[model samples]
Target: MRKILATHPLHPRATAMLAGAGRLAVASALDPKTLTTEARDADIVIVRAPLPPELFQGAANLRAAIRHGAGLDMIPVEAATAAGVLVANVPAVNARSVAEHVMFAALALLRRFRVMDRDLRAKGWLAGREHANSTSELAGKTIGIVGLGAVGQAVGHIAAHGFDLNVVATTRSLRPAPERVGFLSIDALVEQSDVIVLCCPLTAETRGLISRERIARMKPGALLINVSRGPVVDDEALIEALREGRIGGAALDVFSVQPLPPNHPYFGFDNVIVTPHMAGITEESMMRMGVGAAGEALLVLAGKLPVNLRNPEVIEHYRRRFPAGD
Candidate 1:
């Protein structure tokens, strides 16, 4: 019987799927050393954290590592391949969930939802003038997206059709964008946009890509949204901009530090909205991710290419190690 170990927390359905296939080892979380040991006895390992090559070195039977979501930054793909483990990630499965979260954040910030929630609880009246003075209509605003990938494209669709907002993007490559969407230089996008949304991946080239000067160039009163990795935006520089009112507001779903410190200044800022990294979580997203991971695991075990293999080259090395004839 093939053994499968699930280290990260996933939907109950994922556990059921694995159980239906073979022996399933489930854990809410796994220590790095314990996980390494477990992999040796397992045919597949699924997780959401970094899987160093050393962890798989002893896993003679390990065929695949399934990711619960996109963003392979946490895992070492090249290392996994050398160890003959196929690595796969589920992309676009959670795109709609994250895009909706962005819309909620944008609308919440523009309408001052946080402040109103606090005030109403304390005093109990919607002081008309104060609210009206702070709120802004989103219809005519220009929104610049830093990445034109799945989530970015989804956001563009909503903004153009639902809100009639002008959309622009600055992608790694200059590809033809949809109608009413234009490509701009990163600096130009920052300076011209009324709202700046980050949806890119975190790579060496993109680390601190949104530098202090880029933040400084943004249109005054512009709103900033980052659903992407936190380090992409210089956290310290962003704080400074917020302190000086150089930018209007920020809606952050991810932070450089997870579970932001209790005394973090971001919590005290009236113009900033913060949420735990939950932009990609939803009931529907959970189901898709669960099914996707299960399907990939089964494919890898059968010596077939997983549908979403991030490193296709790994197949050559994998076949050499586990010749489970296709």
Candidate 2:
């Protein structure tokens, strides 16, 4: 059987499909040494952890690196293309789950639930009840989205139609947005929005999209929510804003670093809601992503390109390598 490797343990649904097609192997750890060794014999890799460029050099048999989720940042696209490996991702499959997570965090932050619960546990009902009057509601607020991808658009749909909130979005695409969502420049959206949500990808241009100065431009006491990649917002800048109380609060589902380090400053801030990059993870979404990724893997195995192929240029080299197939 063709060898299939995964960076992490696969959901049972995905495991079943992969095993039926190939001899499945999952990495015990994500270190470079382990991955490099494991990838050397792999014909296909299902990626969850970041794949290094050097690993591609050793993966002589690797025909494809399939992403379990929407983002492709984990895989080095240029190196994969150079190595004749097809890169694929399942987009929009988890949009609803991520959008729902954004809404959940936004509501929790606006209502000051973190602080209230902390005080309620520490100083009893009186202390907690005191925070009751300082909360805000979601209705009638304008939500500005940094990106207009599947997750961003899903968030807009819910915020506009379900919550009765005005939605404004920024997108490089010239296509007009839905009637309910007004397309605006990032600067204009920052100034007018009551809630700012980041759902953009992590690119060089977007690495520090929400810089210190960008946060300064927000309406005073406006809330910020990040359901996108962590580096999209400047962590240091965000922390300072929360410390100074310049902004109302923030809900961050992703971060520049994983595990976030024990006793991080974010842990001490009641105004900041820190999640371990789980905005796209839900039981339902997991199944969808697993099935989507497995289906794509199967297609590539059968000498067919993925329907959601991220790097099409790799196909020319791929066809040369798999001459007998495609």
Which candidate's lDDT is highest? 2
Candidate 2 lDDT over residue span 1-326, tens digit each: 79889887778898888777888888979988999899998989999999989989988889999999999989999999999999999999999999999899989988889989989999999999999899999999999998999999999999998999999999878877886999999989988999999999988889999988888899988999998888988889889988998999889888888868978998888888988888889899999998888999999888788999999988879888887554
Using all chains and alpha carbons, the TM-scores for the candidates as numbered come to: 0.94, 0.97
lDDT of 1 by residue, 1-326 (tens): 88888776667877777666678876544667777787788888887665656777898888888888888876778778888788898898898899888888888888888888778777677653357577888898999999988999998888888889999999997678877888999999999999999999998878898999999999989999999999999988999999999998999998888778989988889889998889998999988888889888877776688899888887778888877683
Q: What is the C-alpha lDDT of each candidate?
A: 0.85, 0.90
Segments in model 1 whose C-alpha atoms lie over 4 Å from true places: 126-129
Mark the regions of model 2 whose C-alpha exceeds 4 Å error after superposition. none
Question: Candidate 1: deviation at residue 79, Å?
Answer: 1.8
- Give candidate 1's error at residue 13 in angstroms: 3.7
In candidate 1, how many Å is residue 114 off?
Answer: 0.6
